[model samples]
Target: MKTSISLNQENLSLIPSDVITPSYDRDKVTTSIVHIGVGNFHRSHEAFYTNELMERYGILDCGICGVGLLDYDRRIYNILKDQDGLYTLITKELDGSLTARVIGSIVEYIFAPENPIAVIEKMANPAIKIISLTITEGGYNLNEATGEFDFSNPVIVEDMKNPMSPKTVFGYLSQALKLRMQRGIPGCTIQSCDNIQGNGDVAKKALTEYIEKTEPELLPWIEENVSFPNSMVDRITPVTVAADIERLKTEFQVEDQWPVVCEPFKQWVIEDQFITGRPEWEKVGAQFVENVIPFENMKLRLLNAGHTVLGMLGALHGYKTIDEAAHDKDFQFFLKAFMNEEVTPTLGNLGNIDLNKYKKSLIDRFQNIYIKDLISRICLESSAKIPIFLLPTIKAQLQGKANITRATFIIAAWCKYNDGVDENGKSYAIEDALSNELIRAAALSHENPIRFLQIRSIFGDLIDNKTFVDAFLSSLKMIREKKIKECVAEINSRLS
Candidate 1:
């Protein structure tokens, strides 16, 4: 019977030697990067890379000061703060092995709701050269249809009204950038680690728009000094559950409050256009490219769109996890076909990447037995995800006259999924920012099959395209009449 060692700075020596602990003195590591939206993905991806860079190269200036902007983030803030901003990163390998490492890159965390000024001031610090973000797709506050920053959002509205005490990411950023400008501190690079395509451009647009409205005086300074570098960040970090915490204690004798669990696969491709100096993360498995668009498209169209395919189809078929869906022969066939036929065609130049190898790796990654990425997690906020991840491929396919069978079927499947009941009659809540609208439209799909597509904000003019509308209706009809697995098999057969 072994007692668990609490994972903290003081207990580093007491933790099992098998677990790789940070060798660098964390106290000496200054927070040079102020990261907003400290979530599982940030910890597993960005912090993990920074930790490796520090551990191997002895570069300690890139330590992260994580700021939580949302009320829900208080949980992670409390957990990481209690654990001294130290957490275990457990990578579930393809061979069913787990590699556990303690990440110390996050030396400090500020829950913005508790003290917004602290977060703003921390960002204003001249030493903090790069302000990175992992605020998810929805966090940018972009209107999915207009492709612009939504100013009408209540938080953005309130943020404009009261700039000093900010609510949204844009508000905090505006306030901080203003402080930096007033103090004559050279502007830092605002790097976006979110999944949106052209993430950096989106960040700059959102922030500039917010600032132009709130503090028009700061535009010239921002134009002269600020930089927003686009980046493509890939790592499948599943939401941590209690069992993950218990497993850390039981197997490794390390008790961690929130351990990040992800697949062994990780990749980051960044544009080397930072105004302020950045970490030499290139030495630590991150790719620095002149243009991150090719990488971004390849990842987003294939990996992300692939996840949505499995997630929607799997949910409709009553599968709970990605591994469960990927393990199924039909689901695997459907996903592979969708990737090869629908998505690969839309991808731009990937340079040296082998499409066959990449697609195969994606299938293998999705089937990782240990990751168990929840379909629900993948399915969350499909309203936002579909527009960014899937629809582009659809539009491109529509334009190119390429394979739209599986893509159309996916949209149909998404409609059927929004019915809020699986084929097995199990009721599951449809998780989306526009859940109510989706459900309402989906309910009308029975009478008018195109009702789901009528959400012009999402589907856009695809409803008017005869090829798209006809295929969509055909798929929806088949979905209503046949089992989801049968529908997937049919599409797989047709595509093959």
Candidate 2:
């Protein structure tokens, strides 16, 4: 038998008292856009924002049809379906306050490979105005060094060959656009909400490059029609666990499948570009900016960069959670000082945003004990994350701004942390794709740290400079000689 949690107008209140009652019409909710990777962050940030907009502004033109490409996601897909696509988002504020709201923006869900043609047809619909993504950093077909599309990947090739809206996110997007073009329907806007810098450009590059290699004729069609809007979306949504569901039901009196619990802080800065049409998300606290570069760069460079510092260090010191990491006085001090003294000074205005206020909020969120975002989650894929998150500050410091000694120390700690052994003297599991290569490269550090730095794929041209190189060497040496605590102190001493 079905899970008995099946929700509909006929069985609206029949939903378990534990289930949330969304004050909206379920029948009129249409699948206007198909989101490719419907993960926790997307559910909390984008879903919550859109639900608020629909309720307040009546912009029902964009009900989301969430999709997952991975087989593991099918279980999650079914759970949401059982709940009538409704879930609760618990926003934990810094002031010991929690707000739980029912999210009903996602109308339906489909696991793509299992229902390939169905996904294609749903996306090919003329009414679908946008195709947004939260497929994470590794999902993109990126050339790590060039930060552009790698056209030669097998998935891209398969997408080029089989072509039922390619199975990968890029393929799905390209194929969906192809169908739209053939049907004479306006193509959907592609918005990426991943942490990768220039996320929209990355999406465009992947889709266009695949089309250029596979079907050259389709390239121009994409350029002239579809829009890939770059965006900066921020919210610290921890990877959900079994207890999160129970907490939502017990505390907020709502049952949620894969419920998203996040810090109160949320941000989505988009480069206002909608091909067919778009939601009035601005009414619901989404900022529409002209350029997303400044916002993206600052957040990645300052907040995320700082998080990596505390994250790796925290994990190395056996601290499991971000709140615990933040409570480390030296770590917290270095983080704040790094942001205020080093990173923030280099950044320009980001959509009239108050940079100081933003930093304060980031710091406050990190202190929320209830959220419990793990350092391990933040520590993954350090190689891809580092160049964008930490390298910019390395470059910025070289430009004669404030002292980036702390930021440079972060870069060094990451190097040693990645290579450094635990008390058992064994290598820590490097979770990144280039883990083996990075470990192998760091081995050459015994010969020369400079040579290790020469890997342009990781650091790019930033490694070439002598000034930053010297700082990196000094910090690395200190980290090796003293402990993590001492290294933090030494960097602080130097910057002071």
Candidate 3:
């Protein structure tokens, strides 16, 4: 667990021969994109692509200036600031090979809470074209019931009151855009790299709603100049554990405090609607298309939903990681059935993607033993993820009156998961934004199974549908009585 070299600009040469280091001149790299929410996914996907552009073709204009908005972001802020914004990205291929690369796309970083005005000024800079974001699914601050930006959020309200010293991403963006408009600067693109379906549209809705409440006059200029392009971003970047850091130090001889480890596979399907210029990401395997919804649905339903199926059942069964559950035949069969029977039919068209092959690839990705994607990580934000990834398939299946057995079982398992006790009676905390309410509702489900769905914020009107209620009640009963394994086997057999 000892390290020989610290990762920084000067130590690039001392990095191991096998690991790829950025060859571009860092001094010449210009910050054109200011990315918010600089997390593991952003490091692995967008920053990796941008770094490739700089490393492969010497395209330095698209260098990223990473920004962290939340209080928890202080860790990343300090790590990147200390490490000179350099971190090792270790990619584990399916064949059990590792590729280490030093991603240098993030040339500078700004922690917004330290100096809000400085962050706003950087975004207002004329050279900064795209103020990109990887804020998580719930980070948009949308009201779950109404499907609009939640202006009632405390931080948002604070941002509205004190615009210059903003609290949220929207506040900084609105203030920055106001500065740009005042100085006669052209409006830049506001791109979202989150996993949400129609991420750009969601971003536009949230930001525009914020502007409408604060500065209504900025709307017309934003409409004319700014572009919000929807995108589908995929990569299996697990949260860095203590083991990951030690591995980098022992095997790679690099002491990186906040290195990212992910699966080798990555895909980005973007709508070709950037108002300002974008990086030539297509040169590095990113697909720029006319519409990204089909692809988004394909990825979300198949990959994200599939992960939920595994995570929920896996947690109940005491399986620690995604690979553990994925390796189980029962879990694999259940997931494959859910994807083929429930999800695939709902996806209208995916351009050139073969649905069957995509499903198989997803199964393969889930079973990657090297990835170590934790069940806890997969289940972290279920309240936000389920609506976007899993619920639409359920809704579509209901409309078609198709088999909802597997999907129903997953939901049942989620309810049991929120009960805070696994099948073996071992207790674990529900790591969700709505954990308190979810736990209360789930606890009430013991008397009346419909109580869980009555949480209108999460379930919406799904509780009102008699057919869904019946199936959910049945599934929840089976989960409590028969447990996850037997329940999964029964569902798989029933679907088969």
Name model 1 segments beyond 4 Å from true: none
Query: What TM-score does each of the candidates earn?
Result: 0.98, 0.93, 0.97
Question: Per-residue lDDT tens digits of candidate 1, residues 292-329?
Answer: 88888889888998899899988998999999999999
Candidate 3 vs. true structure, TM-score: 0.97
Q: For model 1, state the Cα shift of residue 158 in Å.
A: 1.9
Candidate 2's C-alpha runs over 4 A off are 1-20, 420-428
What pairs collide in candidate 2? 18-255, 166-171
**In model 2, what is the error at residue 175, expressed in angstroms?**
2.4
For model 2, the run of ten residues with the poorest summed lDDT: 1-10
Deviation in Å, model 2, residue 149 alpha carbon? 2.9
lDDT of 3 by residue, 56-147 (tens): 89999998999989899999999998888999999989988888899999999999999999999999999999999998878899987789
Query: What's model 2's lDDT at 79?
Result: 84
